[model samples]
Target: MIPPPSARPFLDQAGWAGAEILPLAGDASFRRYFRVVEGDRRAILMDAPPPHEDPRPFISVGEWLCESGFAAPAILARDLTQGLVLLEDFGDARVREHLDAAPAEEMAIYTRAVDLLVDLHEQPAQSGLAPYDRAVYQREAALLTEWFAPAAGLAVDASGYTTAWDKVLPIAEQDVAPVVTVLRDYHAENIMLLPDHARSHGLGLLDFQDALAGHPAYDLVSLLQDARRDVSPAVEQAMLAHYQTRAKASPDFEAAYAVLGAQRNAKIIGIFTRLWKRDGKPRYLDFLPRMWGLLERDLAHPALAPVADWFAENVPASARGQLDAGQSAQ
Candidate 1:
């Protein structure tokens, strides 16, 4: 693929003048990635357009992860003004791809991923990170009403949803212990299982620019309750139990997980809907059913009664997954 005119200057400045730039799959963001190859040497070029996307967070978080004994990509060259970074290549073997290619390795691979979290939570969180506080949670969950409600032909107002969430916030925020560096999108696709590397240091991470200081359970929930793929029930249960046992987490950890899971799934439903309606990317819609299912499970937890009650009152059973253009004006 021909590099975009805007990207070529940065690529050339990074000494990839004669390299072949191949398009790599991008995430649900404004940023784009390209694989650069110069003979046997390789690197990844991150094109994060400024004024909308920033590369500073990724650089800072990458440094923190590397310092913390994890495998985040090394930044070879950067031009923050242009929002471009040439990064050390981690190859093309993502954990999800590896598992799909070799089904038998699923359990062991996931265990290692969980173990990485175990190690991360033990260290002190990086300084100056934002908290995944109540406002943040409520703001994110608002996407469900703002975008999904209209797309699904519902006329639900955001006031009731916000009020209900306000009630649930106190209970959900309790027993959260302390927040860590929550890699907001820790999942199979973003983690690499480096061959021949030690289990603890083997996993390579990507897409962590949005890391926040949040409950330890949030990242764990993102990993196991993935939006892109189905995590088997057996594996999810085993991993959850393992994390609780290993982390020596509080007795209320399970409740926190359920509440956060519900909140996250609710946010994603809005995000996916927005991605399709606003951003013109409809592939995210296919995952709505799975998201709804996960949200249902989380809502069932007694700790999420307030939020669940809000959903039951505002969103009718028939309107759960249906999308149209009837969203409330506010």
Candidate 2:
């Protein structure tokens, strides 16, 4: 349900005569996107549905990312009143498409992606233009309680989750690592495989409106433990090694990694939950077990020792089973 003030431009603009616009399939979020072609040129038309969709943050973050050398979609033009944007087309080949065609070549792609992550993490904390503070993280986590927990049909552990949050915040605050403006949704689906450029040498980035200043491990987890797609353990470990080697630390880096992974997964659980109940997108619910498995793997580490105890006391044992049942019923 969108008004046409935003899209009327293509028909009106001098540069875009004969422009044909096609509605593109959208993700779980409220935003709607279209592919526009005028002559040989191609671009995207964005519509952030009103009241439910706010363009301010998305616009601000998009500008910041475009300036920062990350491969986010560029804003060619905007109609703020109608919440629309004309964006550069990054081509349609998502990394998932590439990986699917040649699944065995994931190693080379992993290496390249790991290199991209290292470059992002190496940016200094002062370089970050956004911050992922407690309010942001907590809001994201609440999505789980509100969305997934109900779907799980387990008693929402309001107090227990609060207690777990209390247990982990100190460890997170002690994160001495410098922050970078993280593409909070950085992952394979958002990355494109472009050719003919020295950089990427040809990778494109998309769907990064929620950029934040956060730990180095956040984006890495986002890539390696994606909910929409699965990354093999071998590839995950190889990428981790690439990261460890790139960062060359003074103290134990593994400890930092474990805590960050747990935190990232915890945040994602809530997001997926929210995607289901609030957004009416249930595909993400299937990824809950993968995220849970990540949590369990992370908890095996000694750095998550206290958090493990907290998790054991809370979060149900039949967690995966319940989610599966929910999925089938849905």
Candidate 3:
């Protein structure tokens, strides 16, 4: 793969000039990743073009994770003006792919993942991070009405959607859970398994640039109610129990989890729809059914009664399934 011309000077300054650049992956955003190899030396090149993405949050959070004894990729070098950063390579053992290859290891690997969160919550909150407050919550949940509803050919009750969130979102903001650094996208696909590291330090964290100071339950919900993959109900329950036991979570934690789960799933449904409609990426439509399934389960929780009622009244059962790829909101 050819390195972007802007990357040449950055790599040279980082002493990685002439390294072979191989495309690694790209996510739901404008950012792209490439694995840089120069003989025995290796690192990751994060190309987050400006006006669309920034690398500072990523660098800040990564450095904090390393200092806190976690496994976030280290930032080796940076050129913020061009939105390029050199990060320590965490290798290719993603937890999602790992579990796919060895289904029997699901319980064990997930146990470790839960333990990692338990340990992370023990640290003091990282100062200067954004607070995942009510406004952000309401705005995110509105993605469903703003994008998905139109695409599904249903004109949703947008105001009622906000009102429902206004009622139930406070349950998540309750003092029942500790406020900690919430890795907003903590899920199987973003976690790496480092074979050389001990079990406690085995999992490598990624995509945490959007870290926020929020209730500890938010990240846990993100992990259990994953949008990309179906984490079995049995496994989800077990992990939730495991997290509660280890973290000594409050009795109200489950309520918070359900609320956040519904909120996040709504946001994701909107985001995936936006990605397809606005960004021209139809592959994300494939995950809509799974997202809807997870959202429905969360809505069943008593904590989500307000939001559930809104969805029931607005988004009928028929409109809550797979979206038509041919439909466009543009």
Could you give candidate 2's per-residue lDDT for residues 1-330 as a string of tens digits? 342555866445626656878888787777888888877899888888677777767777776655655566777877666677788888888889889999998988777787777766676543445677776666665665666666777666666665666666555556666667677777888888867433544677777776777777777778887767889988888888887788663254566667767777877787777666666676776788788888788888887776677667656677742255355333
Error of 2 at 2 (Å): 7.8
Write the residue-wise lDDT of candidate 1 on 1-330 in tens digits.
445676777777778788888999888998899998989999998988888899999999999998888889999999888888899999999988888889888888888889999999988888999988998999999989988887776788689888878876666578756768999999999998776457355889999999998889899899999998788879988999999999998889988888889889999999998888877777787888899988998899888888888888778888776354343223
How do the residues 1-330 of candidate 3 rate in per-residue lDDT, one tens digit apiece?
455689978998999989888998789888999999999998999999998999999999989988888888888999999999999999988999999999999889889989999999998779998899999998898898998988888987799889989999888897577789999999999999996666345999999999999999889889988888789999999999999999998888888899999999999999999998898888899999999999999999998998899888998998887877776536
Please report, in order, the local distance difference test score of every candidate based on alpha carbons: 0.86, 0.71, 0.90
lDDT leader? 3
Clashes of each: 7, 1, 0
What's the C-alpha lDDT at position 268 in model 3? 95
In candidate 2, stretches whose alpha carbon ends up further than 4 angstroms from where it belongs are: 1-5, 125-128, 249-252, 321-330
Q: Candidate 2 — which pairs collide?
A: 144-270
Position 197, candidate 3: lDDT: 61
- Which regions of candidate 1 are displaced past 4 Å? 199-201, 322-330
How do all the candidates rank in terms of TM-score, highest first?
3, 1, 2
